[model samples]
Target: MRTSLNLKKVSIALLVVGCIVVIIIAWLNSNRYLPFQGAETTSSGSLKAVEKRLAKLKQAGEKPTLEQLADAFQPLGLIDAHNHNASSSRYLSMLDVWEEYHIDKVVLFGDISEPSAIGTDAAAWKAYQSSPDQFLPFFSGFDLHDEGSLDVIRDNLEKGYFGLGEIAGASTYSPIVSLAYWKASDPMDGFLPEIYDLIATYKAPILLHIDPPNGLPILKLEQALEAHPNTTFIFAHMNAYNSPEEIDRLLGIYPNLYADFFAGFSVYNPDGGGHPEIFIPIMKKYPDRFILSSDSGYGIESEEQAIDAMYRILYLLDDPALAKKIAHDNMMAIIQAQPATMTQLSAIQELASKNGKAYNYDNLSKLEAGKILADAEKG
Candidate 1:
């Protein structure tokens, strides 16, 4: 009878411990949703780290060819404009590839559909804090269906995010899709129109992914483009599944709509998207409309291969000035046009004071201010 009682006592203790463990995990998951959570360093430190990398590159004979530089004295190289979840271990481990290819900047964002994927905006923010110069972080960490999503977008923008996406709007047909479900339904339906207005208010670009590129999606896209003339929408993958003539038509019609031409998808991907050369004429026709990307650096095989495919497209351009425009200038122009707002700078100053770091608030870029504000907020 005594032994039986002891066993009962042991079971109760085990149950109590298990409950505590579960509670701790729940707390951690909730905290992960917060902006800039898990950031390990400060914005100043991040800037210094990138500066050192730049110095090393210069020592290694790397050259800055493009006229537009995101950071002064930094060289202009290929900018991978649509790298999703860039903080993923696989992508982070490939920094050497960025150096080898002379890639100067990458647009970083994360999958925002939670409980299904790495769905926190903090992932991109953390990555940016580590290497602010190498990455331009965009926020898409809110569920489209959530009523609070509008507030989340506005909050992040006010906190100084450079841009708004790589937002997975409608992915009806794609073998490479990471999530089992789409986070957003129709690109123009529900909260997106309001989100576009918020983006326009900040003059920030929103990168959108709508697959199959035809039917009702195209009509809806046109409607959204017409409705939000002030907002800039980057059609992800340059509608890889559609024809170049379609791309030309879209560009000719919508000055507000831009194209994210994923070189990796064009050259590789057995999904039967035509050769990269097929779009060369259209690219030449509308050079400013196109921005190059690696799309999680899939290139069907590896990030390195995807980057190589990008270079191939650059080589085909032949004209250095035109190549420079597509390579980095176009994207930089969109970002630089919007400086850090007075509100953002004020918040940054307050954060800097809180963190015991003295910074010239007047000179901080949106990315820099965002990093500082994020670190302080995390604390």
Candidate 2:
């Protein structure tokens, strides 16, 4: 009887051990598969003890409402490419912040190089993953210019990042900030090729805010094109850094070269040449190549402005086909390029409807614009 008892005990111990091994393997696999949901790290590299607090928030289930989102005139689907709420304190948790605008998706990125800005960014990453319906995250950890940046980029790509972004001040124009930023760092070193190579390998696009004197437009862009011939590059707010002539030249030269026109703050400056007329010729000339971005989501002031402006610009184009492509076709092409689920296809179809007939460029009708915005909000 004693021998029988010992055998039974041993069997139980073995079963427990096997279960533990399986659990450990599962945990390790989860970490590898889910970097966004890993233990949150601070911008300065310290891990915070938010386990209990997060649990409380999760259990309480405070579902942030649309009304909690600040009021905005435009629908949320009207996305702007790069927005940090003008660097405001309220910028944190902006994924929910934009709900009122009815924005279907926004590209959210964080500075991997910030000394004190990492923790919140990790939370933002988790939030997007938890409810991808609410946010389409553009993962960013660090710049290739800095140390360990390549690993960060590669790991993000492996984890299913939308693309790389917000590489500050490397554009074609010479903004004062871009100038100061470049002066502080050396971007042209060996890092450039490695960054471009990884970006190419991932088949991801690079988001940039480059200006001329601060960064080389023609030469640097050419090198990037040569290295990552397959990577689709989307230059946001093609300010002075990327001149009209160069946009035409590079986009013409490389099928992968592209740009978005959302930097409304600068592109729509009173003294600046507006995005539409200045670039519509190119947009029309290369309809399949470019996208129309709001460059928005900062705050009350910029809401709907980019879309409103797009209306005027397309109206100016006076070509039904050109206007339709910018308003819906090009963006649809990008989304459709990927293999989306039936649900994703349906959602995009509705969004494309909104973009297509929302406004007739030649007619200049605010009522038509209001109807589209209203429909999206209802959606």
lDDT for every model?
0.71, 0.49
TM-score of 2: 0.56
What's the C-alpha lDDT at position 362 in model 1? 48
Mind sharing the TM-score for model 1?
Answer: 0.73
> Which candidate tops lDDT?
1
lDDT of 2 by residue, 184-292 (tens): 1323443656776676654566665555523345466666667677766676666433466777876788887667765453335554444436766777788776655
Candidate 2 lowest-lDDT run of ten = 38-47
The regions of model 2 sitting more than 4 angstroms off are 1-77, 85-102, 111-123, 169-190, 213-217, 240-242, 263-267, 297-304, 314-379
For model 1, how does the per-residue alpha-carbon lDDT over 41-101 read when each residue is reduced to its tens digit? 1245544544564455456664433221223222335688988755568557768767666
